[model samples]
Target: MRILLLGAYGFIGLAVARRLQQAGHDIVGFGRDLDLGQRLAPDLTWTGTDLSRLSSEASWQPYLDGIDAVVNAAGALQDGARDQLAASQQRAISALIAACEARGIRTFIQISVPGADPAAKIAFLRTKGEADSALQRSALDWIILKPGLVIGANAYGGTALLRMIAAFPLVQVLAFGKSRVQTVAVDDLADAVDACLAGEVPKRATFDLLAAEPHTLRDLILKLRRWLGLPTPTATFDLPAPMASGLARLADLAGWFGWRSPLRSSALDILSRGIVGDPTPWREATGRDLVELDVLLSRLPSTRQERIFARSQLVLPGLVLTLASFWLLSGLIGLWQWREAVAILPPSISHGLAASFVILGSLADIAIGIGFLFRRWLIRAALAAIAVSLVYLAAGTVLAPSLWGDPLGPLVKILPATALAVAVMAIAEER
Candidate 1:
């Protein structure tokens, strides 16, 4: 089979693509970033297609050619700077279904969620539900697999959040701790896709791929802690609902800046409601049980790199915020004391030249600070910070060399700030 896999570079999609390839299927991958998709799975053919832009059957034709079956793993949590849920999830699927029908391609596999409903209160679930319903009504042989919280070797979205919280030292702070969640290993989800493609599962059916039983969100975190080989925390704090909601709102605001924080309101809403579903349908169909939570965690490698990622993610937001705040304040203070800044230059320099340098440097600092607030601009911001800091250091060394050895160490402090910017640039790219 020559399969066209959408969102082929994503956590779930990549896993499925590899599984299919191992099963001797010729895989053609499609994603928003063609280069990234190719880089992630170099052996597979890849095409760049923004599903949000393909809301009509005509728009899907170019990529659908020579495709025998289609597996849609593409999805967005909510509408934000980089996503349009309705267009990508609902309208595009509808158009794809129509295109597939017109082209006489029947087999379709849809990856969905447990609580998906066309009339659901949350837009993420609603959009997904609308797409699922559309597939159900279409003439194609479609199978929908809605998995619970998917745990994998590499962390992303919900899994990343779990690892981050579990990595905290000596204390555990949790929100929606009592909410129930079933776990599904990413490999198991990939197996479900393989089953669908191999005609091992019934067509025109919906299956919830998950563990045999569910665990509380709190219990799940503890399991993650143990999985990460970390010592148990001495204290556990359950955050109040209002405080959690406030944090989620802040994450919602971050989404507009292209940061896909796991605490976004859409994610919180889903978590608060609980993630659970029956595994009986899928198990009965495949004649096998999904790996239990304990076994799932044990199978995934827990190495030094995973520990580092968890701890780093826990501090990432605060680090970015502190860096941005420092730069902004530095700029604002320089502007507020314009005369003092001008006076700091060498006595040999003209007053106008000193003032011009002060004003431009301060404004550059302000711009870099503002740039750090947007995830899309984070790399550029970090690079700019490094460049500007170097310029300041060079100018300070020539103009006021004594300041480097002064009590305040004003010129010396720039070293750490420049190093911090370089570190941010290193880890800012999202997988």
Candidate 2:
């Protein structure tokens, strides 16, 4: 069987693609990033095309031809430009359906999130509801798989949360910490997709794919922490609804300008309600137990690799601070000596220098990030960068005391970098 998979570069999509290929099915993986596609699932055929831009029947005709089924796994997990989502889902689906129909393709599998209430206020959930509705009404034979919180080794959001708990000895509990969640493993979900494609599952049926055992958010975190050999996290405070809402609103406002706020009120609400569902259908259909959360968390790379990755993330910000310190020191020297240093440098030259610093810093950071991502060369890269950044800071302080400002200014600037460096070290040691 030939499958055209949208969002094939995503966490779930990659897992599904791998499963399909392993089962001897040919797949055409479609995504925006050819590089990510190749990196994540090198074995599969990939097409780098913006799904939303291909709105006409002709645009999708080539890909849909000879495909056995169309799997719509494309959607955003976080808030982004409204136009992008509109194009990816609304416009992309319209074109895909038309192309599939014209090419005599009949099967469509729509992967959705279970707890998405159509009338709910969250835009993400609402858009998912709309897409589910659109697929149900289409002429093609369809299977909708709405799974609960998907837990996997390569998963982003939820897996990140688990890693955080594993790294931190203590964690603050929120309102939804005790709320139940029927987490599902990515592999199990992939199996379900494969089964559906194999015609072993009912058409036009929507199944809530989840783990057989439901656990609260707190329980899940605790298990993950134990798996990573970290001390259990304790809840310190419970945020009030008004306060949470205000913070969420502030985050939404900041998001307008590209400022990301980690916590949101809608997210809190989703957590509070908890997405609980029976996994009987998924278990019966796939005949596999969901991968244990503890096992998945434990399988994460060594502490050293995590440390290197964390260190790499700081390279860009560290470079920014380092260069700013140098620039300010240069200006101060010119001011004190009444020199024409500032006037001598051309504007273009200054711009070029700044760009060069950014490029070099970014490349170094990427190298470390990749090392961290692969769980290799972490300790050496992290330790080396930490020592270098510290030396740079110390030299800047001694050579240009004025640029360092009062002790308080230097302390303030250094604290965050020091904290970040320490975090990298701590994460690396977790392994």
Best model number under lDDT? 1
Residue 365's C-alpha lDDT in candidate 1?
A: 89
Error of 1 at 171 (Å): 0.6
Q: Deviation in angstroms for 151 in model 2?
A: 0.7
Please give each candidate's TM-score.
0.98, 0.69
Error of 1 at 264 (Å): 0.4
Estimate, for each residue in 205-264, the C-alpha lDDT of model 1 and write its tens digit.
999999988999999999899889899899988999999999999989999988999889
Taken over the whole model, the C-alpha lDDT of each candidate is 0.91, 0.64
Worst 10 residues of 1 by lDDT: 422-431
Writing each residue's lDDT as its tens digit, candidate 2 over 188-232 gives 889889889988888988888876677887777567556545545
Give the lDDT of residue 292 in candidate 1: 92
